[model samples]
Target chain A: EFIRKLWEGLLVQSKPPLTSHFPFPAQIPPDLVDKLERLALVDFRTKQGLECLEKAIRFADQLHVVDTTGIEPMDSVLEDRALYLREDTAVDGGCAEELLKLSRKTVEEYFVVPPGNIPLPKKEERSSMLKHSEL
Target chain B: MLGLTLKEVSLAFREGRISPTELCRKCLNRIKKTQHLNAYITVTDELSLTQAQESERRLQRGVPKGPLDGVPFAVKDNFCTKNVRTTCASRMLKDYVPPFNATVVQKLLDQGAVLMGKTNMDEFAMGAGSTDGAFGPVKNPWSYTEPYRTLAGPEADWVIAGGSSGGSAAAVASLTSYLALGSDTGGSTRNPGALCGVVAFKPTYGLLSRHGLIPLVNSMDVPGILTRSAGDASVVLSVLQGVDVRDSTTVPAPSSHAELPEEFDVRNLCVGIPKEYHALGLSPDTRAQWSRVADLFEAAGARVEQVSLPHTQHSIVCYHVLCHAEVASNMARFDGVEYGHRSSMDSSTEAMYATTRHEGFNDVVRGRVLSGNYFLLKQNYQHYFVKAQKVRRLICDDFRRVFASGVDVLLTPTTLTDAARYGDFTQEDNRTRSAQEDVFTQPANMSGLPAVSVPTALSSRGLPIGLQLMGKALDDHRLLAVAQWMERQVGFPSIGVHDDYRQCSDTSSTVQTSA
Candidate 1:
């Protein structure tokens, strides 16, 4: 209500109220529900349930900057976003599958080890995983 | 001449060897001889004499004021002194004298360090070289002086005394006064001290009171001292360190009284050298000197080890962002509202504010302020400002982790290269050199740790190279302990009278004739 009054005072048209219409149960993305839950983590987008979309938009720009000298915005839906959407859609292991694909592709494209390069021994990690010998 | 350290001068007054009047006269004489060095902004002759008389009478009546009693010292103009002009080396405060003394200055006065004068600096302490002062460049006092010392013609060699604290550094280097006070946010104290061949010590953040020093970057700026020796720096610091209610940042750490473990005790002392600091841009002479310093530590029975401060490489960039952001915010208070120079313009009140600031600040300060505002734009703030703050945290954590690994102190070269020609780093590529120059020093400021730069060796070109000793957070005394030991070993020669003239003229290229 405060936002509506502020927008009106600023001579701005109120954005159309978000439709309460629900998607078909069969058409719902597997990750859609999880994405809606994740939106609660973001203070601004908690009530709107739009954090997955926000990350989809923001992380895309970050990925571009890291990938192509800050140019060449990606065309296809990124695997991370797809994984987030899958988690929201409640698909079985769909998020994990998409995440694996994203990580593998990112490693291959951005961090491939170059030939004839000597790599230093990795310093000991402080993580508990290193202590437990898990995975 | 008033040839005494602040402590020594106080002792002399106690012994009746000389009066404060005589000491002030000697400082005045030195100021006259090297007037061209441009070290001072305002000389407080009357004020100094009055203070001197008070100190003398106290001594005569079997009462002594303090450790720095009857000792003359100069302050960087940025620090407010009651009823005295505190310009911050800019025109904005050219005629502005504050009604109160900065807390640090007040503390020093209460301790009896007589204020001889206010010194010159980079306008708002923005430049590395003192060339950006509203007054002008402060010539380095250690120029080559040889054959035919007295030249009447319009020819002589001269260079800058370092920047920000260049005036204070010059004063101490020439023995014009025993010690001078300056502020260092980034490399202001250490850089100028390296160039001028003096001892510059920046204590742990919040250790010294900063209530009166005009804010450059509130989080980064700390009141530091410039003196002739590490011992003197330590003595002055002893008097100054305490928790002040005025500066809320002051920590509750007790004054450092415990002596550092002897250098020979290899049982626990570990000195960590960050691999990132040994980068390619360091001068060959500087590298050799650093190796020599490391070798000395090894000989003294200390275990030296290589440590990786991965975040160290990003410290300078992060420091610039955070400092400039704070500067933008702090300097906005100077918009000619209650005091300071106000400019008249045809535009609106807001436009007048813009014009006043544009005309009031020098180019270097204006550039940083503008760049800071640009970085703080709503969309870009998260990308640059937030990232920089996060990186600053990471840099601090790196030091904490390094110290946690049992390294008591860190060693690095004070500067990437020896001091350059006056205008060498003053181009559009200033950021490249500026960032690179503070490569070794900024992390300490970021981490709020203590660091000191002491002259280690003279380069092939006759300029001094400095070695930096950085201690764990709030372990300032230990840093001084290691520095004092190193200072005694290196033993850089004191500056001579003719050196100043040689640096300012073109013909100052030859070796010293006398000595």
Candidate 2:
């Protein structure tokens, strides 16, 4: 259920780190723990990331000293300058061949990543879920 | 040859008394001689010699590149150099060579500046003691103390060169290079600069391009210049600052602005010394030095007053969260797939990624990445990452409020303490030490303000005590001008080669005896 809640939180929220939508957990679940353990947190050579995680939790409570009421959560921009987007265009500086040289497995124009164990969505289940949502 | 300032070197070259090739050879010899500082990860002997020959040819033609022509300098290894190994002092990029030069490196190259070597730094710029890098601890060139660690190994008491950019500062102070480029992600440049008696400048964010520099914190990381004098910083900053098409976040340079004024009058200036900084457990020597700087400013007809930045206590804690959060995000691309070292190659990609990171990263890097990932998780995102960002704003706002009230600049001590021993620095671990190292310097990065650390006085330990001056964001030229005025007023002594690498007389504490 905790994992489901986390998964749901990720889906519904477009802007992340929303302080509005969380009852933060005391500890990481095993699957997320396992994923973190797989991603950057190794089990053997380095211990599981519980120490850092706990430190983060403890430190997170310190911000409550200030009343953050009516203050919009700050984003990267501090100055109110208008951002002008450049027109969509490709520049010639990119040297694809040189960049490709760094790739471990490349076949002609495409990068060859190792086989990922991602499960494909079942067609019947997808249709049933879509029908239930009345889309 | 190592005694002259960079301008003096340029003058000698202009007067035809010295050739670029000769200067390069002299610098190369000095770098070779100072191998004990561990200042460089890779000294580009052939590359610098080749560049020197080209610069010499230009000089002979009577069309030199610029003021920096033939001036030897070093870039922190984090900056990529095409066909050169650019390690961020990590085993991951130990054997990895780059196919491109960082825009800043290319800029220096354009000026025909001699490239000496790539300096060593904390692994991925994560630590403050400069001890955790793969090359080992960068020794403080000013450490002329007892119980020296040189021959006794860990049992002696020698000082640190300062962190993440320790090699850069040490190289400049030791006369190995005229100037060295160090990335200041919360004091990576200035901390080392303070300890080594060099000028470290963190310019306003987006004022300098971040192209080709390895990302530490995308918002805060900019290539900082380490120089022997405040004026030298201005020269280098002028060359490095501009809009980089590759980096869109750059603040577009003004369409029409005079070249940064190398001189300014000190009269009628309002300088603020933030009161919150004094509460950070300042040492007696540091306190005296801080007061001396304020007195100098006042005597020079500038208004130096104590100002409040109430949110200062939270800045270090705030920086810790922000730095790790970004490190995790930025370093995610280093999975064993493309550029860096690939270890534990296996059929399973997930396993390969985990194993590669574990082996490639040091404990400091891994811990930061893990904590960063934990904070970024959807469930805890607001409670950690967002809260930290909000506090970051409050800190920035504190500066804005202070700057708004007739204050042209703010003054503060660059570091809480003078040079610390390697054994002492490593006691608290990287995470804790980094927070303290960044206490004063992080506010500049946090608020996107321009700050420079100029040497003011020698500490009781015979180390450099740096005084920092911060100005409003986007006013880098003005800040540099003020720093130059202060630099002239203080008249701090320069580091001489005679003082370093001497044997210690007092063997009071061993590594075992230290806390």
Compare the candidates by DockQ and give the number of the best one.
Answer: 2
Native-referenced Cα lDDT, model 1: 0.66
Q: What docking class should model 1 receive?
A: incorrect
The residue-level lDDT of candidate 1 at B266 comes to 40
Runs off by more than 4 Å, candidate 2: A1-32, A39-49, A83-87, A107-110, A118-135, B144-156, B254-263, B500-515
lDDT string, candidate 1, B1-515, tens digits: 44445556666777788887787777787787777778898988889888878877777787776667778888998898888888887877787877678887887789766788998888888767776777777777665433212431234335556666889888887778888888888888898888878889998887888888888887778887888777788878877787776666666555665333345244357887776776656788887888777777777777777777866766666667777667767777775544565555323444335445655765456555545654565765766676666666667767889999899888888887876765454442334445656778878888778899998877776777888889876778878888888887777766655443422443322221110
Best-fitting candidate, scored by lDDT: 2
Each model's DockQ score:
0.01, 0.13
